[model samples]
Structures are given as structure tokens and as C-alpha cells.
Target chain A: MRFLHTADWHLGRLFHARSLLEDQAHVLDQFVALVRDVRPDAVLIAGDVYDRAVPPPEAVALLDDVLARIVVDAGVPVVMIAGNHDSAHRLGFGARLMAAQGLHVAGRTGPQASCVTLHDAHGEVRIYALPYAEPAAVRDALGLDLPSHEAALQAQLAAIRATHPPGVRAVAVAHAFVVGGAVSESERPLSVGGSGAVAAEVFAGFDFVALGHLHRPQTIGERVHYSGSLLKYSLSEAEHMKSVSLVEIDGAGQVTIEPIALQPLRNLRVLQGELATLLAQGMDDARRDDYIYAVLSDTGALLDPMARLRQVYPNALAMERTVLARSGQASAAGRQLRELDTGTLFANFFREVADADLDGDQRRTLDDLLADMAAAERESA
Target chain B: MRFLHTADWHLGRLFHARSLLEDQAHVLDQFVALVRDVRPDAVLIAGDVYDRAVPPPEAVALLDDVLARIVVDAGVPVVMIAGNHDSAHRLGFGARLMAAQGLHVAGRTGPQASCVTLHDAHGEVRIYALPYAEPAAVRDALGLDLPSHEAALQAQLAAIRATHPPGVRAVAVAHAFVVGGAVSESERPLSVGGSGAVAAEVFAGFDFVALGHLHRPQTIGERVHYSGSLLKYSLSEAEHMKSVSLVEIDGAGQVTIEPIALQPLRNLRVLQGELATLLAQGMDDARRDDYIYAVLSDTGALLDPMARLRQVYPNALAMERTVLARSGQASAAGRQLRELDTGTLFANFFREVADADLDGDQRRTLDDLLADMAAAERESA
Candidate 1:
């Protein structure tokens, strides 16, 4: 069966205070067009449909209009779930009612297990709708202290496996920060400490694993894939190509993944040049249609980069100047400071900048920094 | 043509920290069911689809599901616009593309003006989408230096009248605070000073004016009506019967407005009683299906009423104590204090609260309060 597998739409969200609605809408239009052209049997919006638990009205309307066009007008069924960015209670509001209309919404982690089985001409395809889960929630739901996201997910998968008929094709949709996966600077930190990392091997038995949360489309193994966000939500994600994935599963449970292109509303380009050079060249072409982040390399003094860039890119989000390196070698005092342990360096910097007092214990800790830095350097080298 | 007129959806919004998605979705479900049962020709979402310019993702998905079911699945066209709560530029993102699928969206007040002529069995109905026109934007759009919202709106209506064919039924949709219409406490004050109140007669020529912004379903005139918000966004609007207005216009320009019932996910109730009384009453029935606000009227102080209310109605949005009487009554000292001029009262209050020193001029101003109060009282009664 042919189906479109996409995740991390994060609709109605913004990059800082700037609205990403237009960019999001443009990508959604492409997704809708893809559904029409590709004629996929179903569209799996894996998770993270919204950026917050509570979205604004326009965001709601925009999503409503787009989804209506895709599902009802274009004749495709949509299977969606709540992500960490979403409030499960809010998303699950009318799941039972909407499910009757062929739109499957799974916003909650089931106590036992949650899976939606779709029967097509080829065979029975069981979709495990696993919304973003915290370790405590997973443990409580499964009636066991699973310890980690990987272990909890495995437990849930085990429940699904026990219930599933033998030899049926299965796919799991999830939103998590997995171990050994590349993380973009734009993606939010999932958790603190060692608990954040979920082992990618958790989905070993599934035919395919559609992931969300991480905004860069990539694969962990042969079967697990992230569709990424519909648009680059942050300047940090400017280099990543945003797209949805289309997966085809045969009767044998083998899956093939295809990436569909998305038309970006604005081309996020970073221009690195000296202030004078950028001003002389002007931003005539960039001004026409795009959001630009300009970095001006001015060595000697500070300049009003924003004032200059606005003349070219009126919607320039941010601007910064690159500090030039000192021509001569550092002074003995500066070299001593650099060579000091990180703790000593941090203490010295903080004391110099803030003119604050340090306790005897703190000063003693700073003295031990050289040993720590040496150990770290030795390990890395 | 029969259409359901609704506005101020404020999707992905919160009443403080409480998510209103469930309440919003419930009302939208009722709206969808109404459309399915009543079979309206179109749905008019006047404006303010989101509470803020940037909404969370789940709100987007919820709206998407509702619109899909009503418009795309039920074969009903939707006409919507942006309100003051929205960022016009963001809302208008995919308007052009969505227009192809019969969803009309207008976010800005443009020079060309936005008028969509919908063809029906009766005849062509010219629907002019005015969006939320600020005085400044309207003045700029019409090339007038000193245009008020009333004048600008009148000019726009005149332009529409001049352009559209004679005898064609016309209905106008807008998002503005009109004079003599009751404003819900939840609605943000549109304009400072006298600017917010646009005269109702500005919409004189249209057969029907589907209005938004105020989250109360009411009429300014015989033909101009507000559909109100989908749910009570604030405790102040608890008594409001949230609804959608279904309007039917004939070829002869005769208009009929019908109220469509909205089923709130939870009823908003305000309880005025002592803490003990409220608790002893056992709010289990109300707590089970209502978002409540409790006003404690305890003569003697009690420990946190909020904590107590949460023990019963966990979804209580707000709780306040009614220490002061509803009437404007006070003790002799209180009356004397109230008689003080605002400036003097402010200085004295600040002196007492902040323990700050006051000058001789501040003391003299306090003496003038009694004289001003006596004169005002004599003039009044």
C-alpha cells in the first residue's frame, strides 16, 4: 500500500516572535498537491502537528483549511498524533468523533497499547500511534518502571506485538530524541542528563518507524525515518532541506521511502561579507523574495548592520558583525588565561565582567580546573 | 443562500494557563453537526479565528479537522477574514491557493478591495470581505488623510455599491467593534479613546453584515449581527450562550438570521457563597461537566479558596472573594478616603503602601479633595 509518512508539521508556531504561518502554508500546499498527484492511499502525519499546546486562531484556521482540502476534497485519509509540542488532552478532544469521519487522531499514550489497523487489498497494516511519552507516563501506562524512553517504548511495542496477528505488517509513529541521530540546533532539548537519549534499536521488529520532534529528515537505520518539519522554523535549520516522506509497504512487509519536495515560502540565506562590500553590492535580488540573516565582518569598530540591511532586506530577522582576529600573538597574561583550566577561565571571566566576589571554595575549585581540562583534552585527542 | 455565520474562534488560545481547545472543539463539533443537519450553502467565519497571531499546533489540527468535515466533506464553501487579534499578513498566507478549493480568506484591506460573487440557485450574491480595517490602513488604502473607521468603511461600501451590478444581493463581513453593541469583557479593548466605537450605520447598504471581534451573539441593527465566540474565553463571559448565526438571504435582498445552538464542552458557572457553603454543597455534579469560577463571600477569612475549589472543581479558572458589597456603600473613613482627589489619593496611598515621603504640595492636594467631592455631590443630587 502506498502512503505518505510525514511528521513534525508544528503548525501555528513561530520562530521566536516572527510568524512562520506563510512558510508553513506554502509547504502544506505542496503536501496537499503531493497527495493529489501521488495519490497515496493514506497520509500519516506522525506527530507534532502544532508548536504549542495552545495555538492561535489563525493557526487553527490555516490548518483547518489545509487539512479539509487534503482529506475531504482530495480524498485521502489522515492519521495524526500529538507530539511533545502538543497538549495531548487538547489534541485528543474529539478523537472518537473525528475517527468516524476517517481522520484518525491519536493524542494519548494508551494504558495497554494503542494501534490503528488499516486493511487494504495487500494485507493488514497495523500503525502504532505512539505520541511523545515521558518516562513516568510510560511507566504508569505500562504498569512497570521502564527506566528509559527506549525501554518504555519497547514495552509498549511488546504489548502491540502480543495483540497483533502473526505476519501482519506493522509501522510505529513516534516523537523522541533518539541516540546516534543527528540533532539540529533548532530542535528543542528534550530532557536533561542521560535520560534524554532513546536507543534507536527500540523499533527493531517494526517494518518502519516514522519519527517526529527532530526537524531534519534523516534515517537512523534501514527502517526508521524522520520526515522533518514542513518548513525551516529557525535560522539554525536554514541549511536543512525540509520535506515529507512517502513510504510504500508491500505484502511482504518490506518498505521503500521516497522524499517529496516542499516549496519554501522564503529562502533563508545567510550572507557573510564585510559591511562595505555588502552595502556596495546591495541586496536587490535578496530583497525581492526571501528572509535574510546578514553577518557583517567589520574588524575595527561596530556598525549599524540592521540600519544598512533594512534598505535591502526589509524583513531581515537578525544581523551580527564578525569580530576580526588580533594581528599579533596574545600577551603572556592572555595566554596564561587561555591555558588555565575551564573552571578558572570561567571564574576569571565572570569576575572581570561582573566584578563579583568569589568564595574560598570556589577559588579552590578554579585552581583544580587545569587538571580537568588536561584530562578532557587527553580523552578527546 | 443559507450560511452559518460565526466569528472569534480564538483557536489554540488559553484562559490564563487553561487550554480552551476542548471547549472550542466541542462548539465546532456542534457547528459541523449543524451544517450536516441543516445543510447550509456556505459557512461564514467572520474573523478572529485565533486568539493570537501565533497559535500552538494542536489548535491548528483541531480547526483543520472541523473545517475538513464541514466544508470539504459536506461540500460547503467557507468565507473567512482576519480580526484585530490576528496578524493579517500571516492569515493571508495561502489565501490565494485556498480560494481554488472554495475557501475565501481576506486578511488585509487592499486598494482593489475584496468582493467574491458566489453563484447560487437564487442568483449571484456579492460577498464583500472587509477584514478588520484599522483607521490608518483604511485611510491609506482609500488615499484619504483624515479618515475614521466609520468614514473609511462607508467609502468602501460606497465603492462596492458603485462597482457591483445593481439589484444583486450583497452581504458584507467585517471584524470591528461597533457602537451600541454589547462588548464582552473577554474582548481586548480595540482602540484607545473614542476610536473603537464605529457607528453601526457604516454597514447601512448591505443586506446583512456578519460581524466579529465581540464574543457575544447580538445585533447592532436589524441586518447587522455578531455570531460571537465558540466558547467562553474568560470568566466574565460565563453567562453568554455561545452560538453561530445562520443567515438566509433571498434575491429581493430580504435577510433572515437564525441562531444555531453550540454545545460547550464544559459550562462556565460562577458561584457566589462562603467557602464552607460552597464546599458543603458538594459541587460534584457541576464539577463533572463545568469550568467554574467561585466567588467566596466569607465574613471571616479562610485559607486559600482556590485550593479548596480545586479539591472539587479542579478546572476552576478563577476564584475571588466578595469582601466588598455590590452597592457603592462604605464606612465614614472609607467615604472620606473615596472623596479624595485621584492625585492626592494616589500620593497618600503610595505613601502608606510604599512608605515614601510626600511634599507639602501633595498634602495641599489632599485638602482640595473634600471641596471637589462636595461640589460634585451637589451638582449630581
Candidate 2:
């Protein structure tokens, strides 16, 4: 059985408050081309199909196009699950109807409804899709004392394992924070205010485990892998190499995995140097077009450094002075103290009260109130 | 042949800063129930399926479920088009693939792709879908001088009229502000900075014209009708009766229309009376449960009136003083002139200059510069 295992597309992601819709669309176009070339029997997208529960329309449109190009054009069955960042209700809208067209979307983790069987020259290979499970929801559902993320996941796996038929190969698709996987700022915590990591040992029985939720591609155990996010979503992830995993399993249940790196439309990089030299002739044409985080090495802060740097790199997102970083002291002491004015302060106060902008009547009333209070204070004194 | 004609769902609408997803869901639940009970041959959704170009996730999920229930479970065909409030690319994402499943989503008004044919016991009936068109797009595509909304619509109708065959009944589904139709604040302008209403005579050739974009159920001509919105969107539309149009056509090119009212989960109403009297046993239980627009007849302005009103009516959305309405003059002159401090003014200017917020060093520098400027001004005076 051959399958292209990928996850964490994070479509419609905004980087540093800038829209990445066009860049994401470009990468997905290449991804469709790659899927067409491989022509895998099935595609396993572990989780985090969208950047958020409510993605921008452009992102939804892009996903619609790419899914068609894969399921209709490449003739590959797409088996996907909802991740922590995804809303299960929103993602699982047309699961039953779409399954008829070979687009299997699983939003809940269970033994019965979530397992889909596919055949690829080997007998039937059962694919189990486990979406993100909240601990409280799972605890109430199974009437178990599952106080942690690992316990909830373990319970789900145990149910699947109990129903597993002997001698039939199974591929497990899941989204979780597995032990020993590197974390990034972009991944939302699976559990709120608690330990959310699950041990890798629970996935040992599956022939191949396709995982998501971590942006760095790595293997947790034998036959278990994290395909990572398709694109780098955070500045700390600048050094992370994004890739998709392709798994090939033999009839005897042996598995082999290959990591295929995707070329980003615009690479994310951190550039450090003096502003003048950097602008003169320091970087290549490719670096000039990349999304840049500039760390200026100059001892004195230059005037409007970001504006000057944008002349060299149009996509410069953020900048900072390295000298300040090396000072090793917090700069809060040098900040200005806030002072209030009656008119401005009243506007802010009314804004808080009304939860909106101050209208003409409210502003005039505030002005009169301030004037009256001053006069009353004079009279009292 | 009988068909269910509806439009202007405006799913995901935000009324008075409140999410209407729950109200919309309730109305659609009844809408689906209506479709099931009627068991029409086909369904015609003219336009404005979404509240905005990109809808929230919950709205998309709701539409997905309802469309599947109507198309797959109810065993009926649905032909819909995009409106001015929708993004064509987003709404028509899976047009061809969905059409195969008996759900036709049309996004453009061209001659070739906009027509859908449905078969009934009588014979085959042609349903032409006309999505909202920008004058510039229509002019460029047709190579004509389409300077107005009516002109563009006239050209499209003329093209369809030329292609029409004899002795067969046809229905044209459109989204436009037809002449003499009552307007509402909720419907967005179809054109930029000008009149967007088209004449009703443009749709004269069709046996039935299912229309949308006006939130009032009314007839524009012999065969043209507006189904209105499914729910009351604005305060002005609180008195408007909302319904879905049901049309029956025979093989002899004859047509009959009927309006079916929808029962909302929560009704929207405008109430004007003394706040104390209105809250003290004057209104019925049903009105208390409604979305109320309170125009207080109290002569004196009450403090925190909205907060107090919400105690009685949980969904009290808007409140205004009758004195403000009776003043008979604008109140912009009674406003306070803003006086700026050195720090805030400097920070605002610097934000404009750098297109970002100030850090520690910039703040200290601005404070020093402002002090120096103040001293200089005092010395000069």
C-alpha cells in the first residue's frame, strides 16, 4: 500500500499580521503537481487542514480547488482528520456525502464510524482516523476518569485496539503532541492549563502512524512520524524544514517512510548585519525576496531602519537592535509614564463603557462634567 | 412542475453586533422542514447565500449540512447563484463536482455555464441562473457600453432571450435591486457610488423570475417576484413579512405562485414606550423573548438604560432616547475639541512615521525632545 502522508497545511495563515493567502495558494499549486506525479493510491492528511476554525474565504476556495485536483484528477482517496486548531463541527460538515467520492473526512475518534478500509494490491488496509479529543469531553463520553490528555488518547486507542482484527494491517492517522517531538510557538496547546503530551508507546501496534500538530518533521518511534506543518508559521520556525512523508507498506505489514521537502514560495529567514552594508550588496536575489527578520548589529539605532531595509527586502516583517538584546537588561525603566487629559481620558472612558467610539452627545456631556467638577472644587476650596 | 424558490439567507449575519448564527440556524431548520413537507421537484435559491464575501466557520458548516439534507436526503435538486455580497470564487468552489450530486452552485452570468436543466414528470425545464454582475465586468466581457446596472442586466437578458427555444417554459433566477421594490438598510449596494437598481422590464421574457437582494416579499411585474430575506435583518425590516416563494409551472407554459411564511425562533420587533411601563407587565411573554429595538419615550436621559433594559429583555439590542430623535437638529456642533499632550502627540506622530509602536529608546528620546520643545516655546513667548 502506497500513500502520501501530509498534515498541517494551515491554509489562510497570516504571518506577522500579513496575509499569506497568495503564498499559500502558490505552495498548494505545487503540492497538487507533486500529488499528480506520485499518483499514490491514497493520501493521508493527519490534521490541521485549516489555519483556524474560521479560515478566510480565499483559503476555503484554495482548499476546495486543491481537493478536487487531488481526488478528481489524481484519483487518490484523501483520508483526513480534524486537528486541535480545527473545529470538528465545521470540518466534518459533509463527511458522509463526501466519502462516496473517496474524500474521507473524519472529525471524531471512535472504533466504529472513524475507521475506513482501502485496498491497494494487498488485501484491505484499515485506516483509523483520530481527531483531537478534549479531555473533559472524552471523560464524560466514556464515563472514565481521564483527567489528562494522554489518558483520553490512551482510552481511544485501547477501544480501537480491542476492535482490531488479527493479521490485518492498519494505518493510524492522529494529531497530538507526542513525546520527544520539538514544539514551536505556533502550535496551540492541546489541553488548557495542563500537561498535554502523550507517550509514543501507545502507537506501537499500528503498522504506520501518520502524525500532525508539530511543525518540525521528525520520527517519534519506529513506523511513527510527524509530517509537520506544510509551511513555517512562526519566526522561531525559520530554521524548521517543512516536509511531507510518503509511506509504502508491503503485504506482510512492513513499512518504509520517505520525507519529501516542499520548496516555499517565500523562505523565512533571520538576517543580522549593519544596515548600510546589508543594503549595499550583502544578500542574494532569493534572499531579497524572502520574508526577513532583521537584527541590526549597529551600536546606535538608525532612523527608520525598517523603511530603509524594505528597500533591500520588500518582505521585511520585523526588525530589532542586537545591541539592545546583548545589554541583558530589561528596558521597561526607560518607558514614559502615561498622563491623562479630561477630553481624551473621557473619550477613552466612554469607549470602555459603551464598547464603541464616543458620539457627539457623550463627548459634550463629558466636557461639561469635567468643567463643572473643576468649578465645584474651586467653590469648595 | 413544482419548485421551492428562496433567497437572501444572509447566513452568519451580525445584527447590532450580535452573531445571528443561532437565529439563522433555527430559521433554516424550519426551512428544511418546509422543503421536506412540500417535497418539491427542485429548489431554486436565487442569491445572497452568505452574509459576507467570506462567512464565519459556523455559517459554512450550517450551509453545508442544510444543502446536503435538501439534496441528498430530501432527494431534490438545488440550483443557486452568487449575489453581490458573496465572493464568486468562494461560493462556487466545487460547482462541477457538487453539480454531479444534484447541487448546482453557479457564480457567473455567462450564456454557456449558468443554465441548469432539471427533469420532472411533465418534461425538461430550463432554469437559468444570473448572478450579480459588475458593470465593468459585463462591459468588458460582452464588449458593450454597459454604463449602468439596468443596462448590464438588459444585455444579459437579451443574450438569454436570443438563445431561448420555442414552446418551453423557462425560469430566470436573479439577484438585483429591481425598480419599485422596497429597499432596506441591510442589503449592500451592488454598484460603487451610484444607483444599482435595474428596471423590471429586463426580466420580461421568463415565465418566472425568482429574485433576491430586497428584503421585502413583493412582485415587480407579472412574472418577477422577490422572496425577500429569511429573517428580519434591520430595524426598518422589522415590519416586513419574510417568506419563501413556491412556484408551480405546467407543460403549457402557465405559472402560479404562492408565498409561505417562515416561523422564526426569535422575532425582531420595535417597541416605543416609557421604559418603566414597558418593563412592568405591559409586554407579553413572547415579546419579552424577542430581539427588541427599544425607543425609549422617556423625556429624561436615564443612566445605563441599556443595561437595565437587558434585565427584563435578554435580547434587547438597541436603545435610544426619544428626546434625541425629537430635537429636530444635528448635534455635531456640541462636541469637545481634542487637546493633545506632548507624549501622546509625539507617540502618534512617531507611529505614523515608523508604521509601528515605539520601543524604550524611542520613547525616552521623544520625551526629551518634547521637553526641549516646550522649554523653547516658553522661552520664545
Best by TM-score: 2
| Deviation of model 2 at A356, angstroms | 38
Q: Which ten residues in a row are the worst by lDDT in model 2 chain B?
A: B329-338
lDDT of 2 at A95: 65
Residue by residue across B119-194, what tens digits does model 1's lDDT show? 7787898888988866667777878763456777777788788897877888888888888888666786554323
Write the residue-wise lDDT of candidate 2 on A266-321 in tens digits: 89988878988778764565558889888788997589989989988999998877
Count backbone clashes in candidate 2.
0
Off by over 4 Å in 2: A16-18, A87-89, A107-113, A137-145, A234-239, A269-381, B14-23, B53-57, B87-90, B93-96, B107-113, B133-146, B155-168, B184-192, B234-241, B266-381
Q: Model 1 chain B — which ten-residue stretch has the worst lDDT?
A: B372-381
DockQ (C-alpha) of model 2? 0.17
In model 1, what is the error at residue B200, expressed in angstroms? 4.2
Distance (Å) between predicted and true CA of A201, model 2?
Answer: 2.1
- Lowest lDDT 10-residue stretch of candidate 1 chain A: A372-381
Candidate 1 residue lDDT tens string, A1-381: 888988878887776578888888887888888889998877888777887666655675676677667766886877788777766655664454445555677776778556677877887988878887666677877788876667877888878878878888888888888787876655655543233678877777789888888888898888888888888776667888878888988888888998887878777777778767766666447443577777766776755768777777666777655553234333334434543445556777779988995678866665445445433432221
DockQ by candidate, in order: 0.05, 0.17
Q: After superposition, how far is residue A298 of candidate 1 from its true place, in Å?
A: 17
Docking class for candidate 2: incorrect
